[model samples]
Target: MRNIYFVRHSIQDLSVQDDASAPLTKAGNVLAKELTRLFINKSITAIYSSPYARAFQTVLPTAEKLDLIIDTHADLRERQAIWRLDWQEHLANLWQDFELKADGEESFADVERRIVPAFQQIYDDTEGDIIITGHGTALSVLFHHLTHGQFTFSDWQNMNMPDVYIGHFSDENVLVGLEKIAR
Candidate 1:
């Protein structure tokens, strides 16, 4: 079966202000080093990740172990918009209305426009198991699309910092099975 493992990046340095610049925390780094284990004996044709520092750092170990370069995509980066400091509430609102936004805000629909096509390109160009390392919100949106609404904000809320979901797909691009990979 063709599989795509959508990986949510490990814990981020919350102290860092810029979403794109935050590297992993010390504990996050430790967890990242162990990510290679998930792909052992799996034929990963390619590794793709958001160019964000945290996401890139999270998957570096796996890419190195597999001898595959990480293909970075800006479209895979987390939602780039100014949100309230009370992010939990704001995110919950986003889930309720993917189109909800204020001035200088990027709605989930905007995010989907970029991420969906980028994912399609990745799916079309790659064969065998594929790994996509990204942020919580970004991966959640894509997975929700793949699972036909099964993966929701609740699932995203419960996601581990370093979370993995294995999705089995058919040749026609239909999802046949899905499971969260837990350690």
Candidate 2:
């Protein structure tokens, strides 16, 4: 059995000018530091993060503590198509016509394509524990897919920033257990 820990990036300050480039705020940094302590005893094989700054920032503390470099993956990024638009517009359209817009950014489906493969690659490459730092919506989608579409955003939103979900994968690469971390 392989254990996969899916972690949401720390809180981002949207008040900053660049939303995508927004690094972790003071609160986020503090939270990440605390989360790092939890991993001190665990053997985190690798750390994977989204290309976005916020996601990377969230995992930096843990990576630094473990003396490991974070591996960036484009598929681990947030829903890109919604990212380019205004927050309100993005939120409204996200529930409806995500793929209809003709933009270069990625939709939920596009995110799945990248994330699923990345997940498989990670599972294949390592046998112990793997940690991934990603955005909320993208992580939610991946969680849904991992659990055979039984998990939903509402179920995952309960996980706060830097929260971890422990998943068990079988020999066939099927996710068998998804236990939410309560912190």
Candidate 3:
């Protein structure tokens, strides 16, 4: 069985205006280290992460233990927007219409266009258990697609920083099981 783990980046330093440059919070670093416990003995073969700093930081601990180089991909980055702590309504609005693009923002469709294919490429070529580190919006969007739209915005809203979601692919091109890795 092949297992894909989508690991959401931990708490990021919001003071940094640049999303790609933003690093994880000190506490988030501690939390990120704790993530290694979840993957032990899981037979993780490859680690893939968003090029963004925070995303890369989140998976670093696991990569270190496995002695694997994290493969970064641009499409795994978050949705293009200046998201705020109180922007739940804004996110909800975006989810309501997949094609709706806000001023200075990429629509859900645009994000979907890039991330889905990137994910497919990873899924098709990769072997064994894999870890994909990414941001909330982007990973949620991917999860929504994989779950046939069952993973809704509400699911995204409740997501924890440094979240882990496991998907089991028992057969090629099909997801046989899915679940959140609750601590």
Candidate 4:
């Protein structure tokens, strides 16, 4: 069994108002510290993160503890918008706008394309546990893909900041189990 841990980056300071450079807030920092402690005892063989500051920040503490430099993957960045819209208005139309791909952002399908290859590469190269830190919406789509579309929006809603999901893959690359980690 191969174990993959998908961890959402901690709470971002939405006050930043920028798309790419938002940093983690004070609460996010606290959460990262706690997550670091939780990860310290585990055998994490590889650490991968999105290029975004917030996502990198979330994995930094754990990376430090493991003395492993994070491997940044551009494909892991948060979903990009194909069109510019007011952030608040975007939130209101989130699930309703299936055709509304943001101008500068990647659509959900775009995210899936990159995410699958990233995970596949890791699975091919590693025999032990692998950890990935990324954004919420992107992670949600990833979870759905990993579980073969068993996860849904309601499942995404139940997840909290720094949430961890475990995926167990068989030798044939089929997912055997997809479960949320309580921690």
Backbone clash pairs for candidate 3 read: none
**Residue 91 accuracy (lDDT) in model 4:** 39
**Best candidate (score: TM-score):** 3
Q: List residue ranges in candidate 4 displaced over 4 A.
A: 82-104
Model 4 lDDT vs. the true structure? 0.80
Model 3 TM-score is 0.96
Among all candidates shown, the one with the greatest lDDT: 3
**Estimated TM-score for each candidate:** 0.95, 0.85, 0.96, 0.86
User: Mind giving the per-residue lDDT tens digits that candidate 2 earns over 15-80?
Assistant: 886656888889998998888876788888899899889999988889999998999887788876
List candidate 3 segments past 4 Å from native. Answer: 83-86
Query: Total backbone clashes of model 1?
Result: 0
lDDT of 4 by residue, 80-116 (tens): 7644457545633554443456566666677788887
lDDT of each: 0.88, 0.79, 0.90, 0.80
Q: Regarding lDDT, does 1 or 3 come out ahead? A: 3
Q: Quick one: how many clashes does candidate 4 have?
A: 10
Error of 1 at 21 (Å): 1.6
Ranking of models by lDDT: 3, 1, 4, 2
Cα RMSD (angstroms) for every candidate in the order listed = 1.2, 2.7, 1.4, 2.8
Relative to the true structure, candidate 1 has a C-alpha RMSD (angstroms) of 1.2
